[model samples]
Target: MATSGGASCSSSVLPCAFSRHYLAVCAQDGRLRVWNTDTQSLHREFVPSAHLSATCTCIAWGPCRASKEGPQRKKRKSEAGPAPDQQPDLLALGTAAGTVLIYSTVKGDLHCILDGGHNGGVNSVQWHPEQSLLYSGSDDTHIVEWDLQTGKTRCKWKADRSAVTSLCVSPDGKLLLSAGMTIKMWDLETKEVYRKFTGHSTTVTTLCFATSRPPDSDGLYFLSGAVHDRLLSVWQVRSDGKDKNSVVSFTLTDEPQYIDLQTADSKDKAVRLAVVCKDGQLHLFEHFLNGPCKKPLSPVCSVQVSSVGAGEGATPAPVTLLAAALCPDRQSLMLAYGNYLQPIVEKTQINTSERHVCLVRDVHTTLSLSVNAAVSKVKTPIVNEQKGKVLIPGVPGHQAPIRASSGESDKRKKGAGPTEMSIEERLEQVELSTLGRKGEDKGASASLQTDSFAVLLVQGLESKDSKILNKIFQTKKEALIRNTVARLPPPAVLPLVEELSRRLQGHPFSAILTVQWLKAVLTQHTSYLSSLPDLVSQLGVLYHMIESRVKLYQRLTRLHGKLYLLMTQVASSNSSHKVSDLDREAKLVYEEESSDDEEASGDEGRPEDDSDSWEEEEDNEEEMDVTENKENHTEDEEDANKDAEESKANGDSDMDPENESEEE
Candidate 1:
């Protein structure tokens, strides 16, 4: 999909797209456009916010279309789905006018304007796949979820008393995360403020979520780089509830600039990348969320993708990843600058004579299909008495329409009324609808529409490999139970205990019952709920082989309780998208099993959530750095060993003494 190797445009608002071969741009004369680098064509342009008055700051494509339908069919077949639209279309766009607009990229036409969307300039806009929703946050210190299909505001809030600079909807569309002075997380379905993470020391400029399986994750596990002193971080989000060590962080190279992620099954396969750079050159880095940290953060090919190329250009200030479009074959990446204003505007004011504009306009003089000519034939001029000139061009007889500003709602914003209850007490309200149903479910499908559970069997691997995996999982199921019991979130542990109590009501499989109790303690507070469904299935399979239905049922019941905790955690947290992935993975396993069983009689699998703004995202990145390396190292070389000491003398949990001494 590579063109002869260069872009010719002189625009500043370049946004990177995921899964689309073309990238989009917000132009100086107030135009929104897209270019297909592979064909070197300035494909489409639209002016939804009007004139040269505002700079569009953000642009986002709808979630990968096929990804939204990933449940039943994918597990049943080994096939790729449909191709993306021929004309290409972006899902949402936000401008300096404080307007959030939705339109199809193919038509180059405006679909809807989010009326009374945000108070101040709109900074970011995003769409969730699988569901019909959209969200936007602005300089007004508010984030709102809008139903694009309805042109209605599902929910809106005035976040801290400051501007809301960045916005993100988790992969599952359950959490709406907005970062400003402090991070504020909302439960999308019921509109609840589950957490208010207070950690970033300054303004947060960029936010990205990591996937549990890598390569495919969104910004659910948000790592926000603050503009304050430039710190980058990761968070452990779940529906199980909020807890400590929630945020772990690390300082970055230059203001912890724009960051993105990608997942790789192996080196040859195209690795997914999401990047935001503070460098003029577009810096693309691989996001390896699942791999051990010692693995380097590789860059696929960082290049001078966008050049100043003469005219009003001053070496475009640090390029940021504003929007991304991935092509249909899923093999190409499209980068664009969707939301970048203040910097470009500052540079614009420098051209006192508009010499840069004249030069830029001259460069495009060859394309004679003029927008002004098109407007002249169909419209009238809107007069602005103060400027003594025309403001909006419209039909000859039609006047510039008086568009009324959204007056303050007497209803007051939801969740803003005086509250006599404590934060903890308000949390008990479980509509889990705190964030509002505005962000589309990151990706949706029939599999995730239910509440049952399923498992994923490794594909394309040898039987020996499969056996090894089964064995490792079998061992970990029991071992992990003992290891992490104390760390389980209380909400999860209590539900699991209740579930086990119900299963034992049958008065059978007492030995399995005891294992159930231990299981609850082990998985108490970890982000490892992604592993529970398989653990239970494996346990049940063992019992089935041994001819013990009672024990199998008892074991399954106990494991179910633990998973219920994870589901509930997702039901309420900023990381609900991860829960959605877990749920989708289960469907794959079950669908595979069902195919074989249906020939005889029967078979099946289940689904993923997140919570946040409670803990600063930067904090989690710190703990994550060490947690990965500590899993493998030289332990007893300094007599600081634990797990491997009996066989090789190495501690699996903490750093070695030599390293410890180095610290001293």
Candidate 2:
């Protein structure tokens, strides 16, 4: 499978998995594309015939070993195995036929196929980091473990009632994590569920362990993202009684399709977290792998993976992301996206289905400040108690700088020179002065003129923070909601509606607030929004979401009423022997009254029988008039028949005379 030139997946839109040295891609055409990470070139390609015509669904790469420098390390490296590149890095490809095809990249051939363990299509596959074992999850709701050497299944157990969509193994190879409708941690020794994590509201599709362990913490950290829930959660997999298993969670603006973790090149050993979302955007974060976890982790930066070439003000052509991986450097990202506009069969003989991977550079360096740098840049202030002053490092004090004269000597009059301050003192004074100047704007806004709550609400609506948006909707009154929506910018109107639609789904308790916001925005901008194509599309999506929610509520309500009726009947039947005829009649009367009350409540705003009476009267009068008309028509037809008969007799006599004359 090794090749010198660049290569891409031609007929594949399945998942891509990468190791330290290689990246494996499963394409729709039942072929596997493995690329060398260091060289950024195609290493090998495997054909679909090897998989027996089943389409690839997911892929996983075997762990590759890295080299060390010290003599002791060198001795261990020599004994560890072959060099990383020469080693037969295994690529496990899961297919829709309930089988796993393990291919060795160095050998460029199909190594083995693990089958018969699953009865349904395979959804995810993962390799043990240190052991020669492979695990796979399928639609059959079972997780199967396979021994790589024997090429046979070792054990299989039910992971979830729903299909397992993702799998992740711990670095120590003791715990296995499977995600479907929820996330479950399994004990490898017992082959039983240790605990379940229910952080995600919907299906969890992706899971990844942190690149390195956190300092002072024995628990293993991992990340899980739910595509349908649009949420990402960081969890610690340990039975530490003092700490919570859940470290932090984030609500994403878009559904996350993939997540990759890389160790940042810093002294603090921060982790570089990259998330590929459904909106064609890649969100990057520099988080600590050593310190205490914080709430509300925000991305340092977001990169548009799909709209790389789109010009300003132009709608980008739709592209489907097949796979995304972090480069070996961790500062670069490899994005594999499909161009739908390009024809599969071109006029030229060459196939344009494959293209070079889109490499996004400086993913980590693009942050404004590194985590270590930020910590180092901030210094504790020094207080001079004798002088009654607080002197902060890198901050300027109230003193001004002294300008030296060109002709004057260094030994000028000390009193005239204002007792020359040391260089450090002058630097501190300068820093303090700069910071002080920046704070003057607060005084300007301290006047009566200030930003209105409506403006603040608009800012919150435009913000990417879901917390702020949720809080505003949940706490603010209807008047403020209306005012804020009225002040929304033209470009932000569509997005506001879209956000409200998503909020309504995840936070049904906020549905009333969401509806208020939606009503105000659409009512205020009805004319302006109707002219935009994007608005039309967004409104269509919002309509569908609201319709689905309405249907679900209606179905639940009907089910609840049926259950209540059944319970009431059961209770009544259980006590029927103790009740007399009078009690039964009274119970029936109570039911009738309750039903009548419900009907009255349902028809509260409707007019009384007057409207129905008028409609009924009109219908009866029209029917009576129609019957009278039919009777008159029958009488007229009879009269016309008699007149016609008389006319026929006269005409017959006249004709007889005429015929006689003709005969004569």
Candidate 3:
């Protein structure tokens, strides 16, 4: 498709106009074309034959109503008895030569032209849905409200020194939004600026108003996208016009060419926005405007308008989406790229057995190649050890190995022993070699290959067999499991952790190991886990279980300490009582011994002093022995008491105050 002079183009959809859908496209080529969307065929074309240099820069459809107090209105009422059942079809066209052409859709003829309002080319034109008033913005920096009935300008004002590029009206039809260097809201009745928003640092290119209530307040909000700044700002306008708030804003990656808001159905109050960027991509987003505080608008899907070919060795042609319109049925989105119009259809399917519903792009309607699919088609060849042989792994026909020459084969047979040669011959050499090791080096390679825990974990996960995972858990050490858990991808880690926890529940030692592995993983991946809400919640439950186990262990330890202290105190008291009894017995024995010795010495009047001395010496020896015995007994008792006391003191020092109180 070719266009005239590569002028900026625009398109709009007339919903159910003339009992059928129509798409109007203006390419600034001095001509306008209307397409029947249902048939995907051109319905009508308009060209200004008098103005050979004219170009249609913009176009808008008037509201589906006739003026109540105009001559045409009087003619319609006279013919249809004061109540016309149908709406009048009006189309407004803005040209580059400073003209606004109003045409009748039913008659396909020019109705009237509104000129002399702007001294420069018109940039944008919009019609009020509730009134017959038409608004136009021109490069003359003027925003003129034209009275369609009288073909006269009701009010004109300079919006800014720059050209007024875009215009939007509130759904209530009480305010007008004009975008030039900045966005300004004008009170329709007073023709005075109510609020001026100045966040955009560059020219404001396009503007749209949300059809649903804004999330922040019960008011109408408008969205504006600007060039150079790459910002999309949503501004809220209250009913009384006392407050203007910049509710939500988004920074687009690419400069947006056009932005449109569409509602799929009346029942679904949510609005979906279609943004066309300069990079030839169409982005679809769901605007969460009516639900909660500061709800973010999220991307629904995106499609490239043009694709770069792979292996073609040619530069892809640059394609830019100038305009887009959602059909009235909401099933198809039409985009204008250069002079071509493309339709994108929405496809959906339901799985009855699984009770799942999913949406997919229609394969037949897409005109551009998918980047992923195109990339997948490219194959990188791997060079084999033999020269000039390229092996493409995973391809069925490339599995065979290139045969070696007789000399090489003889050298291999001689180097490898007879047993190795026999084994290689008996088993498929190609299969074993393709597994990354020769038959003779299998034992050495196995040990080296098992070093990476990540490789082993991925291998087990990919097997999808419960027995393999179970075997791995039984054979692999806890440290290896921890390493694997730490290294696994986020999507794979959660399921594996859950499976390990379940399998290890019956065995406390294994469960403890699993808990340790999970803790290590959580410690290493705390930031990543926070982003996945469901996985974080699951991990939290597991952590709580582990914490309860730890608390139970601590309580048991405290109980053991208290029991030990009680035993020490009881042993010390018993030892002291035994020492007291032993001392009393020793005192009684000593007294009796002394009485015997004195009686014997007085009663016996022996003539020999030597005999008396010998008897006293014997008595002294016996006393010394008894005293030594008593001292030894006392020493033994003291040692036992000392040990018990020391143990009690040690226990007291080890025990925390809180634990001691709880135990008591």
> For every candidate structure, what is the RMSD over all alpha carbons to the true structure, in angstroms?
42.0, 27.4, 32.4
Candidate 1, residues 1-664, lDDT tens digits: the string is 2111111110132433333345555533345656655554666766553223455666666654443355545544745533432323545777767887776665778777787877677766767645878777788877788887788988886766888777666655677667777776677777777566666677776665544222123213555667634345655454454522334444333453344444233334333443334433333443434322432343444433232332242332222334333333444445443232211110111122221122121111222223454334656677775667422222111222223123423332333543233455444332233444555332222122111111111110112243533332233344344433342323233233333333333334543544544455445533333233122221322222234345457888999999999988877785766666664433222123345333333111201114443144334434554654464354434445443575443434477799889989
The residue ranges of model 2 lying beyond 4 angstroms of the native Cα positions read 1-13, 36-41, 49-53, 65-88, 211-218, 238-245, 263-268, 289-295, 305-324, 327-330, 334-664
The model with the greater TM-score, 1 or 3, is 3
lDDT of candidate 3 over 1-664, digit per residue (tens): 0010011122231111111245565422234667665566666766643233456666666665644556565675466333332333677878768888997766888889998899887878878767778899999999999998899998999998889987877655777888888888888899898888877777776777765343225456667777664556777666555444467766555777666665322224556566666655666665655423364454466655333422235333333444555444455565554323232322222222332222222222244323454346667887675566432122111112222236745664676453233434534543564666534566433322343455466566665577666556664465555555565555455556556555444467666555555666667666655544233224533543455457668988999999999999999999998888764444223233566654544425534456447657567657766876787799999999998889888883467889989999
Runs in model 1 lying further than 4 Å from the true structure: 1-19, 64-90, 212-220, 228-231, 238-260, 263-276, 282-664
In the predicted model 3, the residue pairs found to clash are none
User: Looking at model 3, which ten-residue stretch has the lowest summed lDDT?
Assistant: 1-10
How high is the lDDT of residue 422 in model 2?
A: 56
TM-score of each: 0.40, 0.44, 0.44
Q: Which runs of model 3 end up more than 4 angstroms from their true locations?
A: 1-20, 49-52, 66-88, 212-217, 238-245, 263-268, 290-298, 306-322, 327-332, 335-664
- Model 2 over residues 470-559: C-alpha lDDT tens digits? 666774466556656564555456556667766665545667667887888878888766554233234544654555457668989999
Q: Rank the candidates by TM-score, best first.
A: 2, 3, 1
Q: 1 or 3: which has the higher lDDT?
A: 3
